[model samples]
Target: MRKLPAGRAGVAPAPLPEESASRPLHSVSGTPSPLPPAPRELTVRALVMGGLIGSVLAVTNVYMGLKTGLWESGCVLSSLLAFGGLSVLARRGAPPSPLETNLAQTTAVSVGAMPASAGLLGAVPALTLLGTQPPGWAVALWGVGLGTLGVLFAFSLRRRLLEEEALPFPTGAAAAELISTLHSTGSAYAARARGLWTSGLVSGVLTWLRDASQLVPPVSLLPAAMRVGGMGPETLSLGMAWNPMLLGIGVLVGLQAGLSILLGSLVAWLGLAPWLVREGVATGATPDALRESLAAWLLWPGVGLMVGAAATSIASQVRALPAVLADLRGLARYGEGWEATASRWVARAVLPVILLTGAMGWFAFHLSPLYFLLALVLAVPLCAVCARATGQTDIAPISPVGQFAQGAFGMLAPPLPSLNASAGAVVSGAASHASGSLWSLQAGRLLGTSASRQLLVQLSGLLLGAAVALPTYHLLVSVHGLDSQALPVPTGRQFKAVAELLTARGLEGLPRSSTLATGVAFALGVVLSAAARGRLARLLPSAAAMGLGFLLPASYAVTLCLGTLLAALVGRLRPSTTQTVQSAGAGAIVGESLVGVFVSALSLMRQG
Candidate 1:
């Protein structure tokens, strides 16, 4: 066991024999923290800051997901963004309470995850490819409606997953750690926040110089993008972002995931790409042409390995699902009828929104009533599955689940496949993704915060995120078509390809090579999951990440690895400063991301 925190004068609080390390480290001495409790929580400042931060993150997420087929943890990013903003408020005679901070984070993460959930760049574009371009209002409506539905189901899950099942929501735990550390211990975290701001400032300026260099030609001299071949679409390029965020993230994810990511980068860039080129598996005269060809081929295997690994990891936990569901039986009854009870919360407050959401899908998207109802029904179980997956790995394959929903609905509404795709993605993808965010709230539940408050914040942020993200999605699409290399909405491509293939060729349509790759990758995914139990797994790279590395250009992946290697070197040399370095890195990521958004907006305005 680790050393217990000292209570007073060399005395340590003894832990109970039944206590396990699985519990949060917050219980340092098997006792409540002595920090003064917040008298008032759920402040206006928290809501405003959370919404603003979430909107920024939503835009960033929408943009990044289109490019990378991945999203960062809202809990981590939102916590830092919120704290950095709120600390300024604290200095101006308006310090937020700890509970308020948690509430803000609840809102931030919920909405920050909105773009991916709402399928803005994922399933929505799949519909676009199949002759359906939903208006901005429909996009907003789908996002909020489905997200609220997810929130309702999430309420039912808290007891089952948190209290009974005791699943570890990794990202939520991270937020709680940040919240408790800052509010309780305070000084250590305050200094760390300084590192964040400092790095963010530097990253922001560098991003501006890199992205806006066309306007100021002198700035173009800076090494923003490192391209090896003819600086064209098919170049063997590198994104030398000059953004320190990757290094900081490396520090936080730790040496194992870091090294794994690094290894994947090397394997792809140093070994795989060249091998493919030599064998004529990937052929191009210029680097740019070859990369485009390579990415097309690589995405199949990459997605298969990644999703397969994640699914297999979740599947391994199936034994616990029955127990989790069984635990929910006791918590379903309402206390004393008319008087609202914990059990009746969903029935009384949420059922109306759900009904309205379904109606919206039926009317606006032209989804059949039966299919809409089916989607909602399926959402409950899938949300549960996603929530658990999120708790365990912080990686819920919501898009895949949504795609599954699409297939089910497509079978029923064979003629209007696009409509069914939209319904499935909105219902399953957005809702389940929203449900995954609930695990962050579970962290506050452990600390005795109000679940209702968390729900309020989440719903509010959901609205804000939907509003911002939908319009942002449209703007990005207008500027750079989804098919463009600069904005390759990969998940959307997957959805489109599947929809087209199923519609045209049916089962026989799947390419032989892709099927073979998927099978091999699936087996490897299972193998990785089996090997994931031991401490040595730390050195193991994520099968999903490696899969992504395969899809993305080698330069970007290699740069990411190099950043982490720098983090490893720092951790080895001056371990104490690693946290600070990580904060700086996280800040740099945000800073650069925001700058990218700004530059994109500038270009859009000029074009308009």
Candidate 2:
């Protein structure tokens, strides 16, 4: 429902929901792994560092996601940062353990994920768009409530997805591997760390030049939009971002996702928009006119496709819901033991979720008892669908969930656009994402950590996230503004559109031609998403990537393509350089992102 571009652990972060810990097929061997006797994991030091690291990344995700719809997973990155930091010190006795590293990384992902996972990036802006902007604290509270519920949904199905199923849960596994490798090899991360830090430094400087270079005196126009050569009214305004992060993001995202983005860009910017102009459907006689035209028309198909594909994907997950419940029945009726205790803990953990569903319905959305109950009821199936999608494929198509919610509530809560959108954000934006996060949590279990402890960390992180999400959103909005030409709140804009459409007339209320076009695009998107797993799917683009391609300029998409090409070339020629290249790419993104954040602060200071 939210983001970290290029999949924080793209193939890994997604998780399934189950109560019990089943024996998953081992990473190497087919048998269940031997549960090693663990050491100190929930230490004071880990908590402090986890909180700090989580805060840093939380802010970064919020910033990056709003500026450019990219969110990086903090799991592996946080693991790298933690291991590098602790491995440097000659501690009192027993240096930091892999278990500790696991806990740190777990805490980082849990909290670091809060800002985006809470829907600050999506729902908050939509709320503003509808002219019913909530107080910052209220937004934060709502975010925390949703997060608590998401985690509960995830735990409910953890056992089935982790042990019974053989999903790799890539991000979780990668974190474990990183922790194990660092512990085993005494002094190895230095060279890699150097490469990472250096790349980041270089990237940061470059981004400053593009975004903040002109801030010397009274800042002139185009502070963020640095121009590339050959600009004219009709020259497409296709300029370079100078932000290496996009290129680095392309590398991390790899070929399939990159190519997908490029395909969508070409289709929308190069082909379709022009076709529309010639057919008199859209007018684009000048560069500015053309950009606006594409933004309006091109965005619809991208959104519709995402909606259609997600609907089909979620429908498939609904069939498996009965089995998930059946598997958990025993735990619900457990005899007294650790099993019963754990079950009780899970029950207590979910209590707030249940209570809050009603509270949010009554308080936030101002829904009647029945509507609130319906929202909770609807959330159950949607959560399952979200978790299942995350388990099978690392991609959690969040937009579809919200769109579905919008449609469902449009009829039920009719004409009240704000309530419909707000309720949808509750079900799809927050709860659905939380269920998907369990996919990653189950991975933590496979590595020999306690599920109960993970839940505790997650709840704590949510609190941390709640504290920061709204403030950060307001800060970004203050500096960047909600609708800046450079920093378009794409998710927010989309949500606003859904709210307006649903409230105003519903789909049937729209013109026949507009509906038909969007419907066709939606159908095509459904086909693409459903067939995403086919052998030929590798050649096709992802729904998000395609959608993003449509939304972003052709120049931006080109840079991403170039980075993807570099990774592809490296993989083919020097396979050993792949890891190094990934690190460098990641560093590039970090460096640029840090600079971007710094520039944002300067803007805020100047405003003050």
Which candidate comes out best when scored by TM-score?
Answer: 2
lDDT value for model 1 = 0.64
Candidate 2 lowest-lDDT run of ten? 11-20
Write the residue-wise lDDT of candidate 2 on 218-278 in tens digits: 1122323443222231333344455587778888888988998888887876667656666
lDDT of all the models against the reference? 0.64, 0.67
| Model 2 lDDT on a 0 to 1 scale | 0.67
State, as a TM-score between 0 and 1, how close model 1 is to the true structure.
Answer: 0.81
Model 1, position 284, has a per-residue lDDT of 70
- Shift of residue 138 alpha carbon in model 1, Å: 0.4
At residue 448, give the lDDT of candidate 2: 57
